[model samples]
Target: MLKSSGMWWYEQFARYRYRQGMTYARKGQYHLAISRFNRALLHHPQPDEVCIARGLIYLRLGDLEAALADLDRAIALNPCNSKAYGNRGLVKAQLGDEAAALEDWRVALTHRPCYAEARYNRGLVFAHQKNYQYALDEFDLAIKANPNLAEAYLHRGNVRDELGDRFGAAKDWQLALLNDLSLDAAKKALFRTRRESHEQRLTEKLGAVLAPLDLSLQVERQGRQLNLLIQREPGTPVNYQDVAKLLQAKIVDLNLNWLERFRIIGRMGTGGMPDWDKVYQIYDNCACPPIYLSRILASLLFFMPFGIAAIVYATQVKANYAQGNYRAALTASKLIKWFYWVSLGVFSATASLVVFGVVLLLLRGESLSSIIESIRTMPSPRPYLGRPYADPHPDPSPQPSLPESTDSSAD
Candidate 1:
């Protein structure tokens, strides 16, 4: 057999294996890629490409330490390798070393200014830190480099919103929606900005009757402030009672964690075995229970009467307003305010009553001890029977029988 050229032999063996490893990595056959990369590494001991390929394979498999080792060796072997730094930065980011990751990305950018991946990753790091301006700038550059990048526009829109540029943010979000309709952030923006041609009835009514121009222009008639934004939608009718019911439903999601914990504790409390106490102790030691249920109870106690008063007042106010009885509605609103104060007073008094009763019980256990003593010291009662124990003298022989009084009239 003819002797093969050294370069050709290396190409046939080492290069072929490295290319095969890359193919395997692309197919997500991480283990096979690792094996192929190792074989290639043995043949081409100092090859930066082989080292980088192995690093990428390790990174894909979540083997951060192995990825870092390969990346470090690759960087050492070729100090000017911007791709190695970029790959290493991604691994560092996955490990939560933002500082190290940013540094690597920065180095990658300095070496290869057009590295879009590094720039985008660095921008995300900035966004994670809430440094939105810098994040926005980086995203701007990323978009310039790759104009079709929908994610850059989305994040830039978020950053703009964070910086109080609602119009700009809306524009960006709209563009993002056009690019990718799946994004909920963009959809929310579109919803909020959407408006119809129908005139607000409250605005028209308030405008016609009220005075001082601006004061009369509000969607709601709440004194002189003229704040219209607080009013609910005009025509798409919603039952306030049903809204309150739905609000209670939505509130359940907020307390689910504590509810689950309480359920567990409640179940334990019902068990016959004393082991529940140990479980409770362990849970208490590990995590303090949320006071949300207590807060909910306290808040209900705090606001229930006022809530009922408002509900009662609302029907009267709406009915009066509808009947063109503005004065009655105004009076009803004042009464509502008065009821709020009264409810506050009642809640305070009720709480005081509870505290006072608790203190009384703590001091003297229902006053039973004193009551028992008073009863013990009192004279005993004689039993009633057929036979009497004592009798008083007959009432002095009945004072001589009274003369026939009826004869006085005849005399």
Candidate 2:
């Protein structure tokens, strides 16, 4: 009776410590939680639960080896613990032991037939191995067991896609989206698939409509917008607004949502003249600074003999004028006109200097040559008395002998 009472007391204390550990764990105080778990284990009551809890904490902390050890001990303490097997499978998966992980998951399912998580994990393993049929089966079972499992649907969709059932895959993805509205990946997949389908149908429908026109047209879907590109033939007349209205009518007939806008681009023939209105619009809405074209033209002038600054400035002026910024256009035109006159004046001055310098060189060539010859023929001075210096070039003339000193007595 005394021993039973002692065991009961130890069990109660162990349970209290385990509760404290769980509280710490909930608060993300992992070290404190682990300490309490260790104390709970030391009391030796309900060791399986304590081991499983510590193992999960270790797993959360990314200590795979510790997690494996604790989970193994938990399984040994209670072999029927499905949760221990499931968690061990996760650790094995993290360790890259896929085969072992799959086996663990299977064992877990055997212990608890309704284990949806284990079934889902097994499906993931099959998917990794490229066994699409098996993966699909497992995912289906998992879904049946837990209809609200969004990940199962998401992964099943992928497997279905791999099996070449695009419609089935799309259905699964839609189901996943409906199950979990916050799943961004599912949303993206559904959007992409639906967009591709819409683009294909639109292309076929637009192709039929453009057949009689004998013009090459392309239909592109960009998000909520539909872009129509019409290749313009030389000497062929096309009204862009009319074409836009026609395409919009066709799109409406197809029962698609009214596109946010229609982008009609007319493709000019090779080396053909560009539409001035289009060019103006392009420059008017450009994010570049107003002087961007000016700088580019100035850079080009270094390589080319002609300056293009005036032309670029004129283009900007025309663009601004067409956009109803008449004041800005006038100011730009005046600035460019002044710049052109200044440039012409500078060019004239530079050309005059170059011409004058050339003429001077031509006229003074003989005089300069004669002066250089005189300088070459001039004689060098003799070295000073009593100071010997080395001569770079010896003179060809003989040196005169010094007069012999007559007064030996004076010496």
Candidate 3:
């Protein structure tokens, strides 16, 4: 009723109330936030905004039924509202419907390819199901979407630990702490990961491996230095230098990641730290390849097919590296760079169209809403990566096709 020529006063009030609700929610005052959202709903023409806001508060308050109802209303009001779908996916996951949750997240990503929270939630479920590999992949996508997401790093570290990539896990825990200083869980996990016991275990493994050569190892300087000696049995035919070189090669073939953490200074007839350079070579060979996360982000913003390709290759670089498939990781890294350039070219064309397309639409008497819808439904880039992942849900009643996913980082 309070409309002006250029703006709707009701919309202004709705936005004001929505900001107030968000402030309250951030302060953990969910009930007050819900009240503000309800008031905003009364004046809002597009009720989905209020519905999604209220639904999120209800979800935070553990009122699953209320949250589900609000989210469903939001979806009904605006099927293209990716925020509603992502939140509903969380609700579905909590309600013991993991498959449904996955489906919702897939649809959400179809709408918004860079939805970090949806990816994070999906990763959590996968981790819970013991699908560590899939969980790690999803976490990679979440990190790519929002690099400062500490929880994603923390959980990804857990998945890496489960997969026995303790080195990578420790690195992730460190990154989590770097991003969120107050995250006590990350602090504790990192401390546990780097305890002295790890050094002690490494020392024992090295000693065991070197015993058969009539050689002894003494771990010194707090496990950073190694002292070596040969048991000079009289009339022994073995050449000490040849034995040392052979041991070094055998250590390299051991493929122990922790070996690089120490300087194996030879002593008593064996060469110095240079003899152990093979271990460092092993670390260098197995290192993960380039991620190209930022390039993939640009691709996602403009064209999803290239984004998909970039994401797959970027993820492969890490996954393959973790499994010691350095060749494959490098191959994927090269492929990602190629896709990055292709994506850039596509984005250039898309940007050119966007700058001029708006003018053409407006000149033809098209409204902003219709223009947005046209962009959302823009002929699916099927030849590249196919339509958004919104297949069909298992609801008894038929539902309409969904739009793109929503980025929680933006929300």
Candidate 4:
């Protein structure tokens, strides 16, 4: 017979059977595991642990009645078993007896005060009953017991939101994601709250500007910024530049949590509505796009036409610069560097292809030598003029010859 471990060589049948039952349970063979647990209980002195393990399996399989029976028997065997009470609470909760489930949780908590799982379960029940204050307390206790509990933070955030503590809710959601990055619900909650606050401020401030113009402001989110489209009568005359300037001047004093850019589109000009990009920031250093001297110098040195043209355009377009057009400014300022990199990229690719072809040709030449050698080594490839490389077709005409030496024997 083969033993599984050194301890298994002398282990008793009851403990062995219990371990096998646990192994089968871990492998998700519920029915086979139940039979193994039954067999182990017949020989084991303590049946509470076995019953608790089997009950958990039954609970996972959705057999509430069997799980409840097993848990009740486990509690009878050991009145101090907090696990039995806690899991029985879950079964009762599923059975639609909220009052009895709460009672079970109370007993479980009394048996083990620091049980984080029990506290979390109680928080869910409290939240469901709309007792948000009690739910918040339970979740706080659970988090205190186990600081890394992401679900506890998540539910606590919901309770805080229900209690009108939005700041606390946002903080809780942030903490939940810090503990578990996979909590996308928490991540979305945080993003939504931030966007709401930002858009609310924008609407109030920007909405006031549109009041006197007989226009309505429609704000649509475009990534991290807001796109403001001024809605008006089809034939109404409106200058895109004037509206953009008005929006920019009024938005300078506003405070925001997230938005930094606002794109304004007013009435159609000679062309359609122009997209006016203005970036607003609280900090003085970020109020305008930065102008780096090194960038201009590098552009002028490596790429000539783009650097010179961009610098000239940047200087000529005073209104464009004053309007804080981010994209145009980047193009003017970074054109030289962009061109230098693009040219270098193209040259490097060509050089790489050439190098690869050279290496391939060398390898091909080496293989050709093997073929040539093999042909020469064959029995007799051809009756050539004692040289394998000689031309097979000999010239029939007499070749040009040097003058014969005067002392040659004429035989």
lDDT (Cα, tens digit) per residue for candidate 4, span 1-411: 665665353346777888998999889998889888888887565788889999999999999999999999999999999999999999999999988998998999999999898899999999999998899899999999999999999999989988989899999999999999999899888898887776667777787987787776767676757788666666766666667667765654443335566776654434465434444432323344445446555556645564565466546344445776544544454544565565456556878997786677667775656655865788855655674587789899998989877976798
Question: Positional deviation of 221 in candidate 3, in angstroms?
Answer: 17
Clashing pairs in 1: none
Residue-level lDDT tens digits of model 1 in 294-399:
3333434677866565556656876776676544565566666666566667789999997886677757766756655765899888777678666676666656
Better of 1 and 3 by lDDT: 3
**Runs of candidate 3 exceeding 4 Å displacement:** 1-7, 196-411
Candidates sorted by TM-score, descending order? 4, 2, 3, 1
Candidate 2 lDDT: 0.78
Q: Per model, how many backbone clashes are there?
A: 0, 0, 5, 0
In model 4, the worst 10-residue window by lDDT is 280-289
TM-score of 2: 0.56
Q: Stretches of candidate 1 above 4 Å error?
A: 1-4, 44-46, 174-411
How does model 1 score by TM-score? 0.45
- The CA lDDT of each predicted structure is 0.65, 0.78, 0.78, 0.77
